[model samples]
Target: MSAIITVENVGKKYRLRHQKTETYATLRDTIVRGAKNVFSFNKVDKPTVEEFWALKNVNFEINQGDRIGIIGRNGAGKSTLLKILSRVVHPTEGRITMEGKIASLLEVGTGFHPELSGRENIYLNGVILGMTRKEIQKKFDEIVAFSEIDKFLDTPVKRYSSGMFVRLAFSVAVHMEPDILIVDEVLAVGDAQFQKKSAAKMESISKDEGRTILFVSHNMPAMEKLCPTSIYLEHGTVKKIGKTEEIVNEYLIATNAQ
Candidate 1:
């Protein structure tokens, strides 16, 4: 398999937000403070901001037909790396090179239109995921059938049971047939059955269809079953990268120690 994605010296920075209590009741009071801050050296005249690097000097490459799992504790930059790969956020430094169409399910209902019916949202999501309207039309039935939302297709997604909404969202995302797929732990929605189905579909898409998949999940057993490779991140860095068994064991042991 050839290199489908390459990430070089990638880093992400985020400003620490300090929410100041508002003392003014109206715009005039705020304006007065702003004017005073322009020439004043007093500490109260200016607000201070702090910044931190989320990901630093991160680098990796993924080949075609690879199913890699991203495993880490919370705030470990797993999602941050996925966001960069999905183009949801740009790195503060370095770059990413992508060779094929990429579709990401970073969250459930990410591209869904709440007011629209499930049916309408399907087409909308498909188009947003880079499919043409005609392409969506061609896969319309398959999408609905796979989602099992045929009966409630025309009902607004806002009215859907959480499971129905997740089904519709996951179905639309995975059906895009992109050469590269990035999935976060969005299968937490719906029931156990839906999670199983989604995992199966992802497995077939990556393992059988020769696509590259980057998966993030806390379910170690599921990761073992579905993914062949694992990348363990700790403190915003790749701690270990190798066969799923060894990497997952490292993740579990480290997390338990913590």
Candidate 2:
């Protein structure tokens, strides 16, 4: 099968400012500092700007119906890469080509309207994911059932707890049935049973419906079980991409060596 997603020389750059002061400053301190800086002739207190690359020269290809795991330690550019793929942010360098509709659940309340009712947000999120009203209506019942938040269906999403938010968001994203699903570690907020159910659902969609999935998680066992092929990222770069078991092993060895 041809590749459904291609990432070529992808990189994301961010600016970091280092201030010559206490890391945490109160409002009063900030105001006083600003006044002093404005009146003083010296620029020694000015923050130094530096460029930080969250991702660098990352290249990968994902085939249709593939379940791929992205594993790494904190600050490995995992979230940045996902945001780039989901079009939430643009890469500073290189380009990405995607062949199908994509739905992403990168955070608890991502793509959700906190002021809208759960029922309303379902339609909203579905529409955002490229589904028609009829399509969303067709799967609305299933989404509610999967989320198990039927009682709160008409309640504003702002009233939801983190777990509830995740359930509703995950439910909507999956039920919309986008061609490509990009999931970050937000699922870790759910209960164990819910996580298991979600894993099974993702596996089913990829295996039975031929959808492509990119999963990022720190849960090793879950990652191993759900993804046959995996990419190991370290320090904003791809360290290895191969069978999940081998990659996980290598990552673990390196992590333990540190």
Candidate 3:
């Protein structure tokens, strides 16, 4: 039970631009604006830039086979932290070390190509998750069976509904036998039955397979049941990390106070 993942003093910063002019302009418009700024006597106001910190001084260590839940109000950087851990985005400060392969289902069709058929995206996403073609093939049928998207397997994923995308993506991610699994709130798109199935699957994998999981969700009960440990984030910082029920209750009280 050594630590499988370590996040040290992580922080992410985003620059928010507030511009009076349109953010996107055609080539002709850009040229014209450039000429005005270069030669015209009129002065143009510059867009205002604001610095926003999505995560600040966040630090944690996840043990092998640990099931951890992340909870926070909107804008608390929970998703940002997950993205950093998934390598989809890097932190503006600090460093992270990971010991094993990771599969992340952060959003609908996260690593999928919209123009690719469902079957194609499955292989494509599987590869991105560090699975070899042979490994993916071995689990192909199981993934398809769990997703229940066989009929639409040949269809381009662009045609799929959000729920369909989530089902297929989740299926491939979890079935890939990744050492670490990261799931965000995209599971909300699935139906209730599917959510239950997903929760059960996550629970089983962590217990039976010794897989590590980092889950982010607003469903308090599900988080409590699936994750024995939880972290509560507030204003882009780690507010608390401890037993799931205790952290959940503290979050509820804090949220109610605001």
149-251: candidate 2 lDDT, tens digit per residue: 9999999999998788888888887887889999998657689999889889989999999999999999999899999999999999999999999999999
User: What tens digits encode model 1's per-residue C-alpha lDDT throughout 1-258?
Assistant: 668999899999987645473643368756766888776778364545578888888888889999999988999999999999999898999988999788888887667988999888988888877888987888888889889989998899899988888888888888888899999998666788988898888999987899999999988999998888888887788777899998888877877887
Q: Pick the candidate with the highest TM-score.
A: 1
- lDDT for model 2 comes to 0.90
Give the true-structure RMSD of model 1: 2.8
Which 10 residues in a row give candidate 1 its minimum summed lDDT? 17-26
Looking at model 3, residue 84 earns an lDDT score of 95
Q: Assess the local accuracy of residue 231 in candidate 3 as a C-alpha lDDT between 0 and 100.
A: 91
TM-score of 3: 0.86
Model 3 C-alpha lDDT per residue in residues 1-258, reported as the tens digit of each score: 678999999999998878665666579876776777778677464446799999999999999999999999999999999999989897899999999888888875667999999999999998987789999999999999999999999999999998889899988888978799998976565899998898888899999999999999998999999999999999999999999999999989988998
lDDT-better candidate, 1 vs 3: 3
- Please give the TM-score that candidate 1 achieves against the real structure: 0.90
